[model samples]
Target: MFGNVFKGRKVLVTGHTGFKGSWLSLWLTALGAEVIGYSAYFPSTPCNFKVCGLDKHVTHVEGDIGNLNMLTNVFKKYKPEIVFHLAAQPIVRESYRNPKLTFDTNIGGTVNILECIRSTTSVKAAVIITSDKCYRNMEWVWGYKENDILGGDDPYSASKGCAEIICNSYIKSFFSDRKNLPRIATARAGNVIGGGDWAVDRIVPDSVRAFSEGKQVVIRNPNATRPWQHVLEPLSGYLWLAAHLLNSPRLHGEAFNFGPDHKVDKSVAELLTDFSAYWSGKAKCKLVNKRDNRKESMLLKLSCDKALNLLDWSATLPFEDTIRFTAEWYTSYYRGKKGMFDYSMAQIKDYTNKALETNNAWARGVFND
Candidate 1:
């Protein structure tokens, strides 16, 4: 019930076919928003979008964000008041294989969006999704704040950092006039895991695929640690930020990090253990003891203090709950559960209940009950 912020609003979500995008689209639709989705290539077969039958739920445009003509046409047609950009070459290992693809999609795509925003008049706020790896990680026990240095070890991470830079550049050059230009901000979240993520390199997807396939998950960098959160954690932040942006321009052109509580940080091995537990030990992980050839951060974390202090948002689910929700969704999916769409909506309602019961500010005054 996010303050009825999305009620009757025309919202556009680039990459709406991805795992997190699909979830956000459904949530926004539930809030009475007219959601329009634009995506280039369907990332893979058996994607979350199709699995949930989301194509029937929104006006899905199959096109690339890099194509200014196509993107501008969507803007002109939908006249969306809010936009969320999540399209990217989102894999780090894959980034190493093709840095140019990563750069072109992550950085150039942002440029095209900003260009279209300049030409369009309907967009009032945009929240671009980046990653926690945007920080120049030193592996300290402490978390990285929004002011921390923006750098990355791998191509994927580096591309995100560059994307942040591009956002700042466009905001400074074009959107600096708060009165005339639309509000824009960047969001960085921890390693996101949930159901319907069929990506190759992600731990949750890999574990689920391995367990479902009756194979051992060969986990590389078993000791690497990351701040992990359910996909909802960051999506909630985006929703609130967009709502806030429409109301307050002070947050315009800013960046905020949305991560799990500090206590929730875990290593690869630790999370794999939870997967095995939730799957009745059917999920197995074969740990690789050797160092990874690709450059990667062993420890990555984000400080959510800015979001908590300024936006009054914090993670409502605990680490165990995050894993439980994720595992349960996959289990039910594998079982050929009916009403999977309704089931997904149930998860959102359940999470909202948790937030309301916890007195989360974003939840208290929102939604037309």
Candidate 2:
């Protein structure tokens, strides 16, 4: 797995208390990495980090990414060999409510992380996780590629675009020298769904809340289409890319998209229909044509050709399996299933086996060769 590059490595994951970040940290611990997690605080109640007991497995540090002094001190003290920057205000609707905080945390926080990486000599590789919304969405049917123009009408999307620009600037100005040892890259992933995500305004969590109470879930945009994949899908890409960046200088400052195949694109309605099948309780939804000032992209997708060709990485789960994985997790949690940490780890193992069966470069341990 990941060419065993992560084994015995010192890895720092910012935003470890978040949904995607907790999963990534758990996976790193399984890979035998000495994991250090830094986050401002738990972003939500019933947080994945607490649910999974990650604080026992990794060194957890609570601090804001906006505070350069604290962030820099962590880098200096830990001297991590690899960094995965996932820290940010990650909700779209929340961005609408607090645009200033969104911009400050997403954009300014990224700059602080980059500054730390630039000054810290112990870091060998870093992967900055940005949202797919970073692409200036034209709302066309075609998927966005790596080189596409970046702009966004919404604050969250715009913040991500600004973060990307800042990363590119830092790469070219500070890390571009051939002698520079720190290799940095950015990853853009589409809508990620899996267990342990309890964020506000997301479909999965909202549905879980409603279905548990035998109530109908509200559908805000039933026709909007998105590229949905399991959380492990993108985490695999991030881990693989970080390992490669350590040795492949040409990959420095590159950006790659991790998403499902275009054929897997589904509307919001279709996803709920499939999700309901695996759920045990009465699953129902009510669609309302409510008008709101917060405009979301009607359609968005990403082309992973670069990830496939350059890094030999691609999303491994089919749509059915992705939904099943998510549904099973939430259902089990609701059923009062104990040992969720072990259960989540089992899912990671299952995902790895599936990837190995498909001959994914990272899962087969072939990338190091």
Candidate 3:
């Protein structure tokens, strides 16, 4: 929880209009930080940014991360002390439709962020978010560590892998010994599912859309196993990593993987089943034999030993709670609940409360007074 560390500090978040970014923006505000966001637009209609009224809390700027001039202007205006770079073409299926955009955004956009950080002087810490797919996934049964091979079969995954490399390159080439420059680090996370994510091709959103329409959900790969966790899981890691990097410059240029417990790895169908049980809705999955030419790993997992050992971070939310929290959120929103913003804040409070009460390292002091 490092609420004291962020209080009154200027923090910049790219992709703040998105699901994960919105939640993080709200969290940073609750921590008493002055937050600013720069992204093109909200990718989905019923996204968490609008659901939680994040725009009211953050100075939301509409811009592209690939535009160096635009990003430099934002850096100059905000003069942020810390940065969270989440802007990217995230969807794997969508990347197949437009691989060029994916490569440019993920790889080139990272270069742009590094360029701005290189030129700026107020920044003390920066966390660049990449996917667990950054690993050259061997479809192994065990989990992939941060030191694992960097490779991917799909454009989205490969682009993230390249982004990781680009961050490291920027560090060695420019930021390695710059005393005034910000310390840069990268975070890799597992499949993150949460409320208000209506992106196409994503399992939860696709299922929610179907169930809302009174139709069954269709999944391309029911048996494919993934290390699924709530969005807050990795966000917590990123926040903690950034806080630590501010003090420990040795952590700069390093990477960490934040993922759920190994025992919680479940197939695609298992997750949807849990969602149905939580919502008390008739959720049936219509598994089809058809497959997209784009290849996703059949079995993917991440080992967070490095994070736990180094940053003292862990996944506090269990597998069932992850599903329940997501389902309850969508159910409340669709049922015309009055306290969308309040309920979301309450969930954040509840999660943090549980973590702190249980003495979880990540939530120890994140709650505001």
For each candidate, give its TM-score against the true structure.
0.97, 0.98, 0.96
Q: After superposing candidate 1 on the true structure, give the runs of residues whose Cα lies further than 4 Å from its correct spot.
A: 366-369
lDDT of 1 by residue, 1-369 (tens): 667778999999999998889999989988899999999977766688988888888999999878999899999988999999998889888998999889999988988988888889899999999988888878888888899999987888888999899899989988898876489999998689988889888888888888988888899889988888898888989998888888777789889999888888898898889867878767767999776756677887777899988888899899999998899999999888977788889999999899898888778854211
Each candidate's root-mean-square deviation in Å?
2.0, 1.2, 2.4
Candidate 3, 1-369: lDDT as tens digits: 664689999999999988888888888988899999999888898778888887788999999988999999999988999999999999998888999999999998999999999898899999999999998978788889888899988999999999999998999998888454589999999589988788888999999988887788889888888989988788888888888777667688999999999877998878877887755556766976665545676889888898878777788888988988888889999888976788888888888886786676767743211
Q: How many pairs of residues collide in model 3?
A: 2
lDDT of 2: 0.92
TM-score of candidate 1 on Cα atoms, chains taken together: 0.97
Clashing pairs in 3: 1-362, 1-366
Which parts of model 3 are misplaced by more than 4 Å? 178-180, 289-293, 365-369
Top-TM-score candidate index: 2
- Tens digits of per-residue lDDT, candidate 2, 1-369, equal 787888899999999999999999999999999999999999887899999899899999999999999999999999999999999999888899999999999999999999998888899999999999999989878889999999988999999999999999999898887557899999999699999999989989999888888899999888889999999999999999998888678788999999998878998889999998877658988976664646688889898999998889988999999999999999999889988899999999999999989999999877633
